[model samples]
Target: MATINTAVLDTFITLTGIKPLAVDVSPVLRERKAALLSILPHWEGAEQSGIFAENFFPDRSVGHRKKELDDLIAQTGNVTGSTEIKAENQLRGSFMLNCPNGNIRVFFTLSPENPPLIQQLDFSLAK
Candidate 1:
C-alpha cells in the first residue's frame, strides 16, 4: 500500500510538474461571491436600475454606468440563455452572458464595503 501511494504521488507530481496547494475559502470571499450571484439575474435581464440601485457604489456616476449598460444591452440583445460566472474573487469577477448574438464577457470590481458594492463594471465580446 505504501509503495502504491508513493508511486501515485510521484506520477502525479511528474505529470503536473507542480504540487497542488490546499485552497481555503475565506468567509469574506464567500460574502462577496454571494453578493455577486445575487446581482447576476438582474444583469442577465438587463435591469440596469435593478443592478445599480443597491449593488453599485454611491460614488460612481450613475449616468455613465447607465449608458454603459445600455450599450451592452444593445450589443448583446436579449439574453437567450443562461449566464455563467467565469471567474471571481473578493474584489472582482467575470461573467459570460449567453445571448442571441454571442457570448458576452462581463467584468466587474467591488468596493471594500462590508457587503461589497460594485465599484466598476465593463463588458466585452467573448472570443
Candidate 2:
C-alpha cells in the first residue's frame, strides 16, 4: 500500500499536473487538533462545518475533501501548476495553491470521503 503522503501527492499530480512543494504529515493527534483549532472558528456553523470537524478527528475521514476536489475539477477543469501540501496524513492534507495564474490560499480536507479542499478553503496563505 502507498504511504498516505505518497498517495496524496500522487493524487494531486494525477489530477492537477502540479507537484506540491511541501507536505506536512501530522506525527501525532495533538498537532492535528492544534491545526483544527486554528481553522474551526471560521467554519463553525457553515454547511461544511461537520465535514471539516470530521477530518480533524482521529478517523481522518475525507468525505468533505472529496467534495471540494470534485468541485475544483468542475471549476478549473485542470489541476496542475504550483502547489504546496500544507498538511497530510491518513486523514486530511491541505494545499497552498499557486494555480496557473491565480492567487495563493490554503485548501484542506480530512479524508478521501470528501473532496480536496479548494479555493473556498483558501484561508489567507498557507503558514
Candidate 3:
C-alpha cells in the first residue's frame, strides 16, 4: 500500500509538476469575500435588483446582466445551496448555485480598483 501511494504521488508530480506554495489571504481579499457573501442571500431571494446594481461594475450593462440573471433564476428555481468552485485569488472566482430544477455555475471577475466591484459575471447550467 505504501509503495502504491508513492507511485501515485510520483505520477501526479510528473504530470502536474510541483504544487505551488499557498498564498496568504490578504485584507483586501477578505473584504471582497465578505462583500460577495453578503450579496449572495439577496441573489438567492431575487428580490432586490438594486443590490445587483450596486455590486456590479458601473461600466457593465447592469440592466442586461440583471435580466440574464432573472432568466436564470426563473429556470433554476429557488437556490437551495451553494458550493465554491474556485476562489483562490482576490480578483476572480467561480461558484455553483444549487437549485431544485438545476444548478447554475457562476464565473466572476473583479475590477482592479481599491474596492473591487464585479467586473464580469457569467452563468451557465452545470454539467
Candidate 4:
C-alpha cells in the first residue's frame, strides 16, 4: 500500500483548513457525495481480488504542469485576481483563498456530469 505523505497532506490541510471530523459535507459536496456513496469503500480500500480492483501507484512529480500554472499566474496579474468560467461540458473555477501566505490563486476544473470529477487542479502564487 502507498503510504500517505504527511508533508503534502499537512500543507494541503493547512491551505484548505480541513478538519477530519468536520468533513461531513456530503450534502453540499455534490461531486464528493457521489464518489463517497456510490463506489464501494472496499474498491478503494484493501481486500481486492486483484482481477477487477483498480490499483494506482502514486507520484508527486508535477513539474511540467506547475510551470504552466506559473505562466497563467504571470498572465493574470493581481488585478485580474480570480475567475470562474463554465462551459457546456466543463466547470472551471479560480480563486484567491484566505491564506496566511501572500496572494494565492488556484484553478480547477470539474466535469459537467451529475457527479462532477476534478479533471484538473492547478495553482499559482503571486510574486
The top-ranked prediction according to lDDT is 3
Clashing pairs in 1: none
Greater-TM-score candidate between 1 and 3: 3
lDDT of 3 by residue, 15-67 (tens): 98888665555555445445555665344432342223354645555466566
Q: What's the lDDT for residue 111 in model 4?
A: 47
Q: Considering lDDT, where higher is better, how would the candidates rank from best to worst?
A: 3, 1, 2, 4
Model 1 accuracy (lDDT, Cα): 0.59
TM-score against truth, every candidate: 0.51, 0.26, 0.57, 0.31
What C-alpha root-mean-square deviation, in Å, does candidate 4 show against the real structure? 20.1
Using lDDT as the yardstick, the better of models 2 and 4 is: 2
Error at 5, model 2, angstroms: 50
**TM-score between candidate 2 and the true structure:** 0.26
Identify the leading candidate in terms of TM-score: 3
Off by over 4 Å in 1: 1-60
- Off by more than 4 A, model 4: 1-90
Candidate 2, 31-103: lDDT as tens digits? 4334444444333433444434432533333445445444544444333433435455545555443444343
Q: How many clashes (backbone N, Cα, C below 3 Å) per candidate?
A: 0, 18, 0, 0
Cα RMSD to the true fold for all candidates: 8.3, 15.4, 7.6, 20.1
Overall lDDT per candidate, in order of appearance? 0.59, 0.44, 0.65, 0.41
Q: Which whole-number lDDT from 0 to 100 does residue 92 have in model 2?
A: 53
- Give me candidate 4's TM-score against the actual structure: 0.31
lDDT of 2 at 61: 30
At residue 82, candidate 4 shows an lDDT of: 28
> Comparing 2 and 3 by TM-score, which wins?
3
